[model samples]
Every structure is written in C-alpha cells, then in structure tokens.
Target: MQTPLDTLQHIFGYPSFRGEQEAIIDTLVSGEDALVLMPTGGGKSLCYQIPSLVRPGVGVVISPLIALMQDQVNALNELGVRAGFLNSTLSMEQVRETEQALLNNELDLLYVAPERLLQSRTLDLLDSAPLALFAIDEAHCVAQWGHDFRADYLRLDVLHQRFPQVPRIALTATADVRTREEIVTRLALDEARQFVAGFDRPNIQYRIQQKDNPRRQLLQFLRAEHPNQAGIVYCLSRKKVEQTAEWLCREGFNALPYHAGLPAPLRATHQSRFLREEAVIMVATIAFGMGIDKPDVRFVAHLDLPKSIEAYYQETGRAGRDGEPATALLLYGLEDVVKLRQMMSSSDGAESFKRHEQQRLTAMLGLCEVTSCRRQVLLRYFADTLEEPCGNCDTCLSPPETWDASEPVRKALSCVYRTGQRFGANHLIDVLRGSSAEKILSLGHDRLSTYGIGRDLSAEEWRSIMRQLVAAGYLDVDPEGFGGLRLTEQCRPVLRGDQPVFLRRDIKVPTARPAARRAVEEIPEADMGLWQALRACRKRLADEHGVPPYVIFHDATLRAMLEQKPLEPRQMLAISGVGDSKLERFGADFLDVIREFEYTHS
Candidate 1:
C-alpha cells in the first residue's frame, strides 16, 4: 500500500501536501470524519481525494453545481484516475452506465450532484458497493443563512445516516463563524475533526477606489493595469452585466456576459470559453463562479459592493488561484451602499434573515471604508487573526490619510437632526453645501439655522464624511424613508461633543496611470517565441483530449518548463508539476520543443 505522500506525488504531481491537507487525509483514511475550511486553491480536494485512492471503495463527491462535477471529473481523468460523474448533464444511458460502475467498484472516484445523490435509485445502488468515503464539496450550501443555500444540500445528511460506518469529509472555500457552526450542526458532523486553513491569499493584491464615473474608471483600470490579462468583472445586476460586457467588447476586449437570466446553453458556452481561452474577461453577476476551477484568472474587479465579506472573499479567491500574483480591485460609492440596503430591506426573507443580511452589508461597508489593512479586516470576520498588516492591500501599499472629522461630522449629524432626520444624504449635503436647489427653497429650509453651515467643506468632502459616518455607525440609513440618514446610539458621544471623530480621507487612485507590469511579463525577448510555441503545443493536445488546456499542463507548469529549458525526459521529471503520469504522457513532446529551441539558439 502506498502512503498518502507517495500517492500525492505519483498521481497529483504535487511533491508535498499543503497546510493541513496531510492531517485531514490521515484522519479520513483512518475511517474518521473531518470538516475542512480551506481557501480556494488551497488543495481541499486532496484531503479527501488521496484517502479514497488508498481506501477500499470509490470516493463519492457531492457537488452542488453540475458544471463543477464535470470539471472535477475531467481533471481527475487526466491524472490517470478512473473518475466519473452523475449529473443532469448526463443522458439516461450515461447515468445507467455510471451507476453500474459504482456497483462494480470500477471507479476510484465518483462525482454526483446533490439532487442526483438524493434519488432512491442512486442510494440503493451505493448500498451494494464497498464504500470508501463521502466528500461534501461546498458544504456551506447546507446553511440556510448562507449566500448560496441549496435545498438539495439539506438532504446530504442522509448520506451519513445511510452509511454510518463510512467516513465523511465536508469542505467549503468560504464560511464565516456563523456559517461554520451551521454547517456542522446541519450536516451532523459533530464528531469530525476540524481543519481551518489561513484565509489569506498572499499572491493577490487588493485595491478599492471610490466610484467616480465608474465605467470610465473600469475601462482605465483594464487598459492601464490589466491590458490583455484574463479577469472577471462582477456587476450588481443582470442589466449591468450585459451592459458592461458589451462595453468591454466594444473596447476590443474578449469579454462575455454571464447571469442567471441568460439561456442555459449560452451561459455554459461562455463559461466554457472562459475556462479554455486565454485573456478572456467574464463580466457577470454573483450568479456565476461558485466552484470554478480555472486556475489562471489574473484579476477580479467589482464594479459595485458585494453583499458580505464571505461573498467578497470567495469571489476574489478565484483570482491568482494558480498561486501567481493577481489583483482584486473594487469600485464603490454612496449609491452602492444605499441600493444594497434598500434591496436587503425589501427582500421577502424572514425578519431574522433580513437582520443578518443588514449586518453583513454593514461589515462590507466597513471594509470599504477602513483606513487599516483590508486583508486584516476580511480575515477577522472569519475568526482568524493576522498579527501584522499585509503589504498586499491598497491601505498597506498606499495608506490613506486621516483627518480630524469632528467638526464636519457634528455639522452633518446636526443637519440630519435639524432636517427632521428623514432626508437622504444628497439632500443633507445640498443643505450643508448651501445649495440653492429649488427643493431646499421649496421646503423652506433656506431659513433654517443649519443651512449652509458646512460651506467651508467641498461637496465631495462632505459626501465622504457622510459615507464614512454611516459606515462608522454614527448614522444609519432609514430603509423605510428612502435612505434617510438617522443617528444611532453609538453616535451619541460624538454628537454630545464628549469625544472627537477621526475618519480616513478617501485617497483617489488615478486610473490613468499605467499599471506596473508583472515580473513574468518581462520574459526575455529571445525566449518569448519558444513560450508561445509551448503553449500552442499544449493547446493542441488539450483539444485532442477534449479537455481544458490546464488539464494538459497548467500555465505555471509550462513556464517552469520554459525557464528550465529541459532537454531530456529525465530533466522533465524534475519540474514542479511533473508527476509520473504527466512525465510519461507529454515528456517527449515538450522535450522535442525545448531541444529545437536550444539547437536554434545555439
């Protein structure tokens, strides 16, 4: 019997397990249960995948998305593993064949959608096989309060009830403290050993800019910072998604729109293209990218605010998944917050759910407004602490300036109060800026003592104060009053002049400046042609195999090969991602390419 480490290198090409992966695998291999909380690209699959290979029967992976299941199985097959999936995408004949494989013990791993696994026929088929273990991917879907709840996921606990002796491992890439507790309780994993990996993605640089002509800003960021890199630009709605994608295409970028409203076939086509093509930007809403396995996304840009820290973390995790340097940029403003709060208030969810949503939104706003490290604030939400500030985020890279906002805040709050506290920020800003807008004159507010009290501050500056005040809990948005500003109890001290107020001055990042090019992009001009040749070879092989190009060889692996300039088969084995299977399969082809390049150069 091979040890887990041996199986890892021989099959997966990775020389060593990452973080707690070995420990988690050991627990499951010993016929014990486990719960794994790992960030995206943290090797969560290895925790259960290696154990199934060493165990007696096939490993069953319960995935929530049909596309996710198919992608996983395709990647596994490339590793020389006999893997198959049962999902709605399969025909009746294909489903029957997969069921037969399950009973015959012919497969090392089987991927199943939650809905398909809940079928009585499938459960009965599994009863006849010697079970290895059950792996639940995206376990957060079982939590009703989570952002991506699936009713079918609730039925997953039946797997434990049916196969009492089979070990189970539940895994998720995103889960806050509350969602973690809920998954353990709802999935009946009380006894499973828990593993929580650090939520930090050091390779990703975070940047947030206050929205000003958002379309122009996004275009500038793309043209200057990301030129031809593959990325995902997330929008707040389907309409925005369509408009943004079209706009990007018009600007000569290979951009596509993806949302739930699109036809299923079209969405699938766009997703497939994104996975297979290089430098394709996917403009989409939150409905896409739940469990995408694409490894080389160069960036993730948000045109609007995300609903919560968890959602933001998960979405941004998609970038730099290959462990290469990537960027996460966000553009937000006062309207984003107001629109989000208004949507939350009008949701038909239970009152408790609405309250939780509001709290999450508040936390998100706090992240956008924080003067300190954005990474620290994000991790703290997940109950993880980073002792030092990360130099990767916007704040660490270009720290914001703070101003003594006491006098300005007092004026804003006083204006809110004097205006009956039922008016919105725009109205208050107009009043404070002494705007002679007809409404102010119509409301007879020109005669009020607080009118034009903040004339010394510019309109933009006052707007910043109001935004930060709301984020700092000094003021609250009245959902029922069309986003009116009202004071919270937390603001009493500042309002009564018992304490001073300090706020981070919004630092405007000039989008027109050229983004610093990545180090990899500085590849020697001589080697550039060879690099493209190697990629073309990989693409051809991938097309022949009917799989994503990464399945043949990840771009990182190709770069390593290119830089190392391996001339012999033995040299190929020494590459980082070259395991026994891959070296045997493509070593000769890659060596041929490298040998030709060397001969020509010499």
Candidate 2:
C-alpha cells in the first residue's frame, strides 16, 4: 500500500503534510470520521483530497454553491484529475455523460449539491460505487445559526444513516464553539476526531477607522498601501456599492461593482474580470464572494460594518490567500451600529437567538472601537490568547494618545439636549464648532453656550469620538426614528462631571508611498539557467497533468528553490513557503531535477 506521503507526491506534487493534515489523513485512512476547522488558505482541501485518492473508491463531495463547485472542478480538471460536478448548469446530455463517467469509475471525485445528493437516483448511484469517503465543504452551513445558513445542510445527517460504511469529513474555515457543536450534532459525528487549526493570520494587518468622508479615506489607503494590488471593497447597500465603484473608477482605479441586484451576466463578467486582471478593486455587497478562489488579493476594505464578526472574518480572509501580507480595513460610523442592531432586533428569531445575535454584534462593535492592538482583539474573538501586541496593525504601529474630553463632551451633550436631540452628529459638530452655515444659524440658535467650544478638535476627531460614544452605549441612533442622535443614560455621569471622559487623539502617521509598478518578479540572475530548466520541466508536467502550471509549483516557490539550490528534502523545507507538506509531497521529484542539473553541469 502506498503511504500518504507517496500519494501526496504522486497525486498533488507535494512532499509532506501540513500541520495536522498528516494526522487527520492518517486517522481518516484508518476508518474514522473527522471535523476540520482550518482557516481560509490553510490547505483544508488537501485533508480530504489526499485521503480520497489513497482510499478505495470515489470520494463524494457535497458543496453548497454551483459557482464554487464549478471553479473547483475546473481547477482539478486543469491538474489532469478526473473530476466532475453535477449542478443545474449542466444540460441533460452533460449530466448523462457525467453519470456514465462516475458509474464507469473513470472519475476520482464527484462534487454535488446537498439537495442533489439527496435525490434517489444520485444515492442509488453512490450506493453501487466503491465509496472512499464523504466530504462536506463549508460544513458550518449545517448550523441554522451560522452566518451563511442553508436549510438543506440539516439533511446531511442522512448520509451517516444510509452509508454508515463510508468515512466522513466535514470542513469549514469559520466556526465558533456553538456552530461547531451544531455541526457535530447535525452530522452525527460523535466519533469524529476534531482538528482545530489556529485562526491567526499573522500576515493580515487589521485596521479600523471611524467613517468620515469614507471615499477619501479609502482612496488615501489605496494610494498609499496598495496602489496596484487586487482588493475587494464591501458596502452594505447596493446603491453604495455602485456609487463607490463608479467613484473609484473616476479616480482612475480599475473598479467594478457587484451586487445581487445586478444582472447575473454582468456580475459574472465583473467577477471574471477581477480574477484575471491585476490591480482591480471590486466594490461589492455582502452577496459577493462566497467561495472566491483568488490567491493574491492584497487587501479587503469594508465601507460599512458587517453583520457580525464571523461574516467579517470570512470576507476579510479572502485576501492574502497566497500567504502573503495583506490588510483588512473597516470604515464604520454610529449609523452602522444602529442599523445592525435594528436589523437584529427585528429578525424573526427566538428571543434567545436574538439575544445571542445582539451579543455577537456588541462584540464586533467592541473590536471596532478598541483603542488597543487590533490583532490582539481579533485573536481573542477566536478564543486565541496573544500575550504581546502585534506591531503590524494600525493601533500598534501608531498608538493614539488620549485627552480629557469631559468638559467638551458635556458641552456637546448640552447642545444636543438644548436642540431637543433632533440632529445628527454632523449638525451637532457644526454647532459646537460655531459654524455659521445657514441651517446651523437657523436651527441651532448660535447663541447657545456650547457654540464654538469644540473648535480645538478637528471634524474627523469629533466624529471618531461620537462613533466611539455610540458604540460605548453613551449615545444611540434611533433607527425607526431618521437616525437622530440620542444620549443614553450612560451619558448622565459624564454630563454631571462624575465620570472622566478621555478621548483618543487621531494619529497622523505617514502613509506608505506606493511602490513603482514592476513586472512580477522573474527568476533572479544567479539561477537563471536552473530556473529556465525548472520552468521547462514544470510546463511539461503541467501539460501531462492537464492542470495550470502554477498548480505544480507557483513561480515564487520555484524561484526560491532554484536560488537556494537545496540539496535534500530537509534543505528544501528551509525554502520560504515550502512547508513540511509540500516538501514531503513533491520534494523527491524536485530533487531529481536538481540532481540532473548537477550531472549535466559537471
């Protein structure tokens, strides 16, 4: 029998197993179920893919989205893998062909939708096949309480009852304790070994800023940190998505909007363009990017607050999927909080469910308003404890100082009260700054004692403070009420000078200037000859495998190996990005090329 390592190299062109991948594969191969909670880009596919190839029969994969299944099938086919997907997109003729291939044992894996899998014909087909295993991708969808819940997922437990002989594996990138339990119970995975990988994506720098002229802030960020890198900017509303995309395009950025409201073909075209084009920014609503496989997104920006932290994390995880550095920026304001709360409160869920959702929303708000390390706060949400702060996040890189704002807050509160609390933050700010705008003069009665008292702080700073105040529960935005600002009871102490209010000063760190656009790094001069030879070999193998060239070995990995000239598998492991999994799986094949080079040179 071939060891898992052998299958890894022969099938996937890698040398060894990634963290817990080897263990999980070993357990599954030993006829045990497994639940894997690996983060995005953490090689979750390999755990099931490798086991499927090594085990006896065809692996049955249940996926939720047709587009996602199509992409996976396309990628596998490119690698010369006998993979096929059954979905609504397939014509009757195509479905017949796929069924014939499956029955004939010509395919290694078959991807099906949950609803399709429950069909009597599909189950009968699987019953006759030499079954290797059952794999559920995005397993968290099983939980009705999860962010992307699907009712069909609850029926997956039927697989355990019908095909008790086949081993099972459920995989998801985002799941908390509650969701995990729900998945296990729903799937009847009482005996499954659980593998939870650390959720830390150290390469991603988390940054949050209060919304003030959000467009300007986003432009500034793009100009400074990621001038020509691929990115996604998420908006809560379709109109905002369209407007933001248009604005970015007017500013000379290659941007497109994607929302459910758009025609399906237009959305598909925009998605395809984003994938193929470099440096394109996609402005989209939450409806976009469920199983996007793009590997080089440099950033993910949110123009509004996400519904919950899980949604936020999953969306942001789309960036830096290639294990390179990236950024996750959230731009939000008081209005976002109120809107989210109102949506949650009005949801047709049980009281307990509503309370749980409210708590989750509150936690997300805490993260946004936190004055400490953004990374630390994020990691804590996933139950990971970090002792020292990560210096890469905005707060850590540039710590903001705080000033006593008790008196100013009092004056601001007084103006709001005197004005009958019928105004938004902008109007209140104008009044405090003694703006002589016609509206302010007419509505504000410039004679108020608070007028012009807050001129010391800039408009941006005031907005930040107000946002924080709202998040901290000292202020509220009436959702059914025109979003008028209202002071909460918590504001009473600060107004009466019984509580100290220290406001964070806005920090103005110099932005990273955009680097001059250069061609994607080619093989360095020192290993030009070896690099050429490797490319030739990679191209030949890729052709044989019928997969994209990068599937065999990414250009960067190949370049690094060639430059370092690793003599052995262990030495290859030392190469950046060549983890133990790749070294064990593909090391010998690469070493053979190196040995040939040495022989020819001599």
Candidate 3:
C-alpha cells in the first residue's frame, strides 16, 4: 500500500501533503470516520481523492452542486483516473453506463448528488458495491443552521445507518463551532476524528469601505489597484449584478454578469468565458460560482455586504486560489444593514432561526464597521486568535488618527431628536452639513439649534462620524420606521461630555496612480509561441471533451513544460500541476506539440 505522501507525489504531482491532509487521510483510510474543516484553497479535495485511489473499493463522493461534481470528475479523469458523476445533467444512458461501471468495479470514484444518493435505486447499488469510503463534500450543508442548507442534505444521515462499515469523511471549507457541531450530529459522526485547519489566508488582503457611489469605487479599485486580472464582484441582487457588469463593460472591462435569473445557457456561457478568457471580471450574485476551481483570481469585490462572515470568507476565498496575493474589498452602508434585517425578519423559519440569522447579520455588520484590525476580527470569528494585527487590511494599511468627536456626536444626536428622529443617515448628514435640501426645508430641520453647527467638518467627515456613532452604540436605526436614525441610551454620556469619541480624521486624498496591469507571466522566449499553440490545442480538446480547459492542462503545467522544454512523458510528470492522470491523458498530445516545435525551430 502506498503511503499518503507517495500517493500525493504519484497522483496529484504535489511534492507533499499540505498541513493536515495526510493526517485526515490516514484516519479515514484506517477505517475510521472523520470530520475535516479546512479553509478554501487548502487542498481539501486531495484528502479524499488520494484515499479514494489507494483504498480498496470505489469511493462514493456525495456533493451538493452538479457543476462542482462535473468539474471534479473531469479534472480527475484528465489524470487517467476512472471517475464518473451521476447528476441531473446526465442522460439516462449516461447514468446507466456509470451504474454499470460501478457495479463492474471498474471505477475508482463516483460523485453523486445528495438527492440522487438518497434515491432507492442509487442506495441499493451502493449497498451491493464494495464501498471503500463515503466522502461528503461541503458537509456544512447538512446543518440546518448553515447558510447553504438543503433539505436533501438532511437525509444524508441515512448513509451512516446503511454503511456503518464504510468509513465516512465529511469536508467543508467554512464552518463555525455551531455549524460544525450541527454537521457532526446531522452526519452521525460524533466520534469521528476532527481536523480543523487554520482559517488564515495570508495572501488575501481584506478591505472595507463605506459605500459611496459603489460603482465608482469598484471601478476605481479595478483601474487603480488590479487592472486586467480575473476577479469576481458580488452583488446582493440580480439587477445589481447586471448593472455592475454593464457599468464595467461601459468602462472598457471584459466583464460578464451571472445569476440564476438569467437563462441557463447564458449563465453557463458567462461562466465558461470567465474560466477560459484571461482577466475576465464576473459580476454575480451568490447563486453563481460555488466550488469554482479557477485559480489566479486577483481580487473579489463585494458591492453589497454579505449576510454573514462565513459567506464573506467563502466568497473571498475564491480569489487568490493559486497562492498569489489578492484583495477582498467590501462596500457597506446603513441601507445594507436595513435590507439584511428585513430579509431575516421575512424569512419563514422559526423564532430561533430568525434570532440566529439576525445574530449572523449583526456579526457581518460588526466586521464591516469595526475599528480594530479587520483580519484579527475575521480570524477571531473562526475561533482563531491573532496575537498581532495583520498589516494588510485597510485599517492596518492606513492607520486612522482619531480625534475627540464627543461634541459632534452629541450635536448629531440632538439634531436627530430636535427633528423628531424620523430621518435616515443622509438627511441627518444634510442637517449636520447645513445643506438646504428640499426634505430638510420641508421638515423645517434648518431651524434646529444643532443644524449647521457641524459646518467645521466636510460632508464626508460628518458621514464617517455618524457611522462611527451608530457603530459605537450611541445611535440606532429605528426598525419600525424607514431606518430613521435615533439616539441610543449610550448617547447620554456623549451628550453630557462625560465620554470622549475619537473619530478617524480624514486624510488629504492622494493623486491616484494608474493601476498596474501585470501581464500574465509569459512562456519563455524560446517556447512562447509553442506554449500558446499548446494552450490553443488544450482548449480545443477541452471543448470537444466538454470539460474545463484547466482539466486538460493547467497554465502552470504549460509554463513548466515551456521553461524546462520537457522531451518525454516522464520528464513532463516532474512539472508541478502535472500528475499521472494528466500525463496518461494528455502526455502524448503535449509531446507531439513539443516534438513538432523542436523539429520546425531547429
């Protein structure tokens, strides 16, 4: 039997197992169940994939998304492994063939959806087959409290009852303590070995900005910070997705919008374009792109705030998957908070569900508005402690110099009260800035004693102060009204000058430098044209096979071959990202390209 390290080198081409991958795999292969909580991009797939190959019988992988299953199967098959998936996308003939293969003991791994796995026919087949192990991908879905809960997932516990002999391994990229416990209970893996990897993705720099002309801010971020890089911009609604995509296009970006509302073909096309095209920006709602395997995503921008830190972490984890530096930018405002609260209130769950959802939303808001190091707060949410501040986040990068805003906060609160506290942040800002907006005049807010008293501060400065005031518990948004600003009981200390409020002083805006558009590292001069030709060939083959191009040959593999100019299959296998499956599947094709190139160029 090959050790996990040997399997890693022979199959996946990675030199070694990353972090706890070996430990988890050893426990599973030793015929014991395990629950693994690994961060995204932490090589979670390898833990199961390697064991599936090394273990005796066919490995049954229960996954939630059909697209994710397809991607995984295709990638596995590219490495010369016998992998198949049974999902809604497959025809009857395809399903029958896969079933026959499994029964014949000709397949190593089979990816099935939870819904399909629960079916009578499928369960019966699995019972007859010699199952090596049962792997649950995205295991957090089994928990009702998890953000992406599915009814079918709740039925997965039956797998344990039926296949008590087969070792079960559940894996998820995002799960807090509550969700983790729920997963363990729901999956009946109470005694399973628990492996919790650290949540830090040091390559991703986190940033949060108060929303001000979000589109403009996004455009500025793209143009000034990360020009011409693959990225995802998340919006809360489909309309916003479309609008943001259009705005990016108008601004000369190679961008596309993807959401469930669009036609399936269009969404697939857009997703394909993002995968194959270089530097494509995908504007999408949460419905699109989970378990996406694309690497080299340079940034993830959230135009609207995510509902929970879990969602935010998972979404941002999609970026910088290749272990490169990336950015997670969030644009948040008070309206986002109101919208989230409304969503929670309107949800059809029980009171406990509503309360939990509200707490998650509140945590997300706190992450956005917290004055401390953003990374520290985020890691602490995942039960990880950071002894020092991560100097990459916005707060850390540009440390705000705070001043006493106690009088200004009191003044703002008094003005809200004098105006009956019926106005939102914008109107309150207008009152503070003494703007004679039509609404202010109509309400006679201009005559208030606190009105115009904050003239010393700019509109932006006053808005920041107001946000801090709300965040610091001196004020609250009225839930009954249209999110009107109101003074909280905590406002008393500030009102009487008994407390000091330190506000972040706004700095002089610096001249913006044009964002550096880093070119995708080119194949060496000797093999540049040949590498492009190989990539073109790979894409054509991928299209014919109906698989993602990366499954054919990752860009990294091509670059390696170009630099080393590998002459044989064995030599090619030595390249990073080129494993046995790839070598067996596409080695001959790649070798043909290299041979032809050498002959012509010689």
Candidate 4:
C-alpha cells in the first residue's frame, strides 16, 4: 500500500504536499469528505489525485470542462497514471472501452462531465463498479448566484444521495463567504471538513490603470515586458475579441481570437493551438478561460472591466499556474462603469441577486481606484488578509501621489446639481472645462454659475476626480438608467464644505511595470545551447505525442537539467519532476543533448 507522499513522489514527481494538501488527502483517503478552496496552481488536483491512487478503487472526477479533460488525461497518462475521460469528443467505441476499463479496475482515475455523470445509465454503471470517491471540480458552480453558474452543477448533491458511503471532495479556486456557504448547503457537504487556503497569488503582480487608448497601452506593455510569451487578453465582447486578435496579429504577434460565437470546431482548434504551442496569445471573451489548464500563461490583460472582484480574481488566476512570475492588468474607464451598471440593471436575476452583483461591481470599481496595495483589498474580499502591503501591485511598486480635491469635488458636485443630474461625465466635463459644444449651448448651460468654473484643472484631471467620486459612493450613475452622473447622500458632507476629499493623481502616459516577482532561471551563455536543445527535444516529443510541451517536462525541469547537467540516466532520476515513467520515456533524449553540449564545450 503506497502512502500519499509515496504516490506524489513516485508518480507526480513532487517531493512534498503543499499547504493543506496532506490533510485534505487524508480525509478523502480515509473515506471522508472535504471541501477545498485553494487558489489556482495551488495543487488542488493533487488533493484528489493522490488519494485516488492510494485508495483501493478509481477516483471519479466530475467537472464541466469536457474540452479540457483530454489534456488532463493525457498529462496523467504521461505520469504513468491510468487515467481516462468520458466526454462528447470520444467515439462510442472509445467510450465503451473506457467503461469496460472502469469495470475491470484498470483505471486509477476517471474524468466525467457533470451532465453525463448525472445520467441514470452512468449512475447504474457506477453502482456496479468499484469507486474510491467523487471529486467535484469547479465546485463554486453550485452557487446559483455565482459568477460561473451551471444548472447541472447545482444538482451535484445527487451524488451524496446515491453514493452515501463514498467520500466526496469538492474543489474550487474562487468562492466568497456566501458562495462557500451556498456550496456547503447545495452539495450536502454539511459535515465535510473544509480547507480554505489563502487567496493570494504572490507571483502575480496586480495592476489597474485608467483606460487610455487600451490597444496602444496593451501593445506597449507587451513590447516592453512580455514579448513572445504565452498570455491571455480578455475583451468584454466577441467583436472586440476578434478585432483585438486581428490587431495583435497585424502588430506582429502570434494571436488568435476565441469566443462562444465562433464555430465549436474552430474554438477547439484555437484552444488546441494555444495549449500545444508556445508564445501564443489568446484574445478572448469571458467564454475562453474557465477551467483552462495551460500552465505557462505569463500574463492576463483585461481591455475592459470584469463584472466583479470574483470574476477578476478568476480570470487573472489563469496566469502563472506554474508558480513563476506573471502579471494581471486591467484598463478601465468611466464608460466601463456605466456599461457594467447597465449590464447589472438588465440582468434577469432576482432583485437581491442583482443588488448583490451591483455591490460586487462597486467593489470591483473600488479596487481599480484604490490607492493602497491592490493585493490587500483583493484578499480581503475573499475574507483573507495580508497584514502588510504587498510590494507586488502597481500601487506598492510606484505609489501614486494624492491631491486634496476639496474644492474641485465641491465644484464637480455643484455642477452635477445645477445641471439637473441628467448629464454624463462627458457633458459634465464639457460644462466644467467651459467647452463650446453644441449641446451645452443648445441647453443654454453656458450661462449657469457652475459652468466653466473648473478651467483651473485639465479635462483629464476633472475626469479622474469624477471617476473616483463615483467609485467612493459620492456620486451615483443615474438610477433611471440614463448613464448620467448624480450626487449621492454620501456627498452631502462635501457639498457643505465639512468633508475633506483626496484622490490619486491618475498617471499620464503610464509606464509599463511588469510582474515584480523573482526573475526567470538564468542559463549562462555557454549553457544556452543545451537549454535550447532540451526545449527543442521536448517540443518535438510533445508534437509527436499531441500534448503540450510542459506535460513532457515543465520548463522548471528543463532548467534543472541545464543547471545540474545530468549526464547519466541514474543521475537524471535525482532531478525534481523526473519520475520513473518520464525518465524511462524521455531521459535518454535529454541526456543525449547534455552529453553533446558537454563534449563540444570540453
């Protein structure tokens, strides 16, 4: 009987369990349940993978990511774990063989779609087959009000009713206090041991800047820091995704567009290319990144605002899955806030749900406007806290200077009041900066006392003040859904000159600050050739096997090979990530590259 640690070292090539992994694995292997809330790339998969191997029967993983199951299974097979998946992508013959394998106890782990797993036929088949436990991935989908709700996932509690004795482990990367409670209620995991890991991804530098020509900003940022690296660029609309992808391609990047609007086959092809190839940038909508397993994504850039803090966290969490340095950037504007408000107001959810969403959006906006460490506010949203400011976010890296906006805010609020609160930021700015625009003259607002009083500040500066006011609850978007600015009760103190106002000075021509985590592993000039040769060997093997190069051996493993310069097969096994299966399969090729390099250098 192999222990969990033994399975981890011998199979997954990891030396020790991370964080609460060992605890979670023990609960499951002992035939108990656990609900895990670990961050992405925090080794959530191993909590179940190890228990499945150590326990007697096959572990059943229920997830909605059918498109990703094949890649996961392929990676597992490379580790010498007998893993298989049942999804629409497989033919009937293949499905039959998999079912038979499950019955014969040949598979150590099985991945099943939530819909398929809930079917009566599949349930009956599982009843007769030996099972270790059920592992539910993306467990937050159980919350009806969650950002990524799936109706099928809400009924996952059926597993408990049907298989009462089998242990169940539910896992998710993003879940708030409310969502966590809802997950416990819906999944019938009332007694399940809960493991809540910290939500911080220290390797990811959090950055949010006011939108100023987003395309140019993205291009400059990429050219400056992340050129030729794998990344995801998120757009709010399908059209924007396509346009950005095309634009990036024109700008000499290997970019592709992915959206639900695309044909399914085309989406699959683009996804495959992004996964199998290096340096591919995927321009996509929210439809693209759920359950994405790509490990080396260096950055996730948002051209627009995400709807909530959870959505932002989930989207950005996709980067740096391999625990290397990464960046999560957001470029937003006042229009983005209005658009997001309109989106919330139009949703078909219950009033309470919509209000909850609105609050979340407001918090998201606050995050963008925050003057303190972005990481602190982000973790606090998930009920986790960092006592000290994280030295990794935009604010912590380059603290913005604050201005006393006492007089400016009063004038801005008075302008909104005198104008009947029917005008948006542009009109208000026009009124403030004394524009000779037709609408202002048509409305005869050029004669008003509040008009033209703000000429002391630039239009951009006024815009920044108004944006911060809205974010801080001093101003509200028109309740009538007219996209106009209105004064809130919170502004009364400022209106009476009793409150002092402060705001961050928005950066003009903002500089690109890349992720401030540790640098990439250095390969000396002499060792660079062997490094390239090893990567080339890995790429060729990955292409032949039809899997991603990382699954062959991650970049970290390749660097270890470079640093250690392992010359013999026995020595290769001593490197981390070199298990018996991979060492047997690919060790000779890497050793051959190292030997040739050494001979040439000597």
lDDT of 1: 0.88
Q: TM-score for every candidate vs. truth?
A: 0.97, 0.85, 0.92, 0.98
The superposed Cα distance between candidate 3 and the true structure at residue 391, in angstroms, equals 3.2
Please estimate how well model 4 matches the true structure, expressed as its whole-model Cα lDDT. Answer: 0.92
Off by over 4 Å in 4: 512-515
Q: Which model scores highest in lDDT?
A: 4
- Residue 200 error, candidate 2, Å: 0.2
Which wins on TM-score, candidate 1 or candidate 3?
1
Sort the predicted structures by TM-score, highest score first: 4, 1, 3, 2
Write candidate 3's Cα lDDT for 1-602 as tens digits: 78777778877887777789889989988999999988888888888888888899999999887766767887787677789999988899999999999999999999999999999999999988988899999898877887788889888989889988999999998888888999988889998999999888877888887878877788788888788888999999999899889989999999999999999888878887887677899999998777888887889999888989999999999988777678888888778876777677777899999888867876887787776788899989989878998877777767667787778878888888888977888888888888988988998888888788888988787777777776666777776678787887888877888888787665443335222223345456876789788888898888888777777766667777787778888888888877777677678888888888988999
- What is the Å distance of residue 363 in model 4 from its true position? 0.8
lDDT of 1 by residue, 1-602 (tens): 88999999888887788789999999999999999999898988888889999998999989877866776788888888889999899899998888888888899999888898899988998999878999999999998988899998888889879999999999998998889999898899999999999788888888888887888888888887788889999999999999999888999999999999999999999998998888999999999998889898989999999998889999999998888888898998887888888999899999999999989989999999998998899889999989999877788877889989898898899899889989998999999888899999999888788899999988888888988988888898888888898989988899899999999987566544323224344667888999999999899888887788998888889989888999887778878788888888877888898999899989
User: What is the full ranking by lDDT, best candidate first?
Assistant: 4, 1, 3, 2
lDDT to native, each model: 0.88, 0.81, 0.83, 0.92
Query: After superposition, which runs of candidate 2 have C-alpha atoms over 4 Å from their true positions?
Result: 338-355, 435-456, 513-549, 561-602
What does each candidate score in C-alpha RMSD? 1.7, 4.9, 2.9, 1.2
Candidate maximizing TM-score: 4
Worst 10 residues of 3 by lDDT: 509-518
lDDT of 3 at 40: 81
Instruction: Residues 211-295, candidate 4: write the lDDT tens digits.
Output: 8888989999899889999999999999999999999999999999999999999999999999999999999999998988888
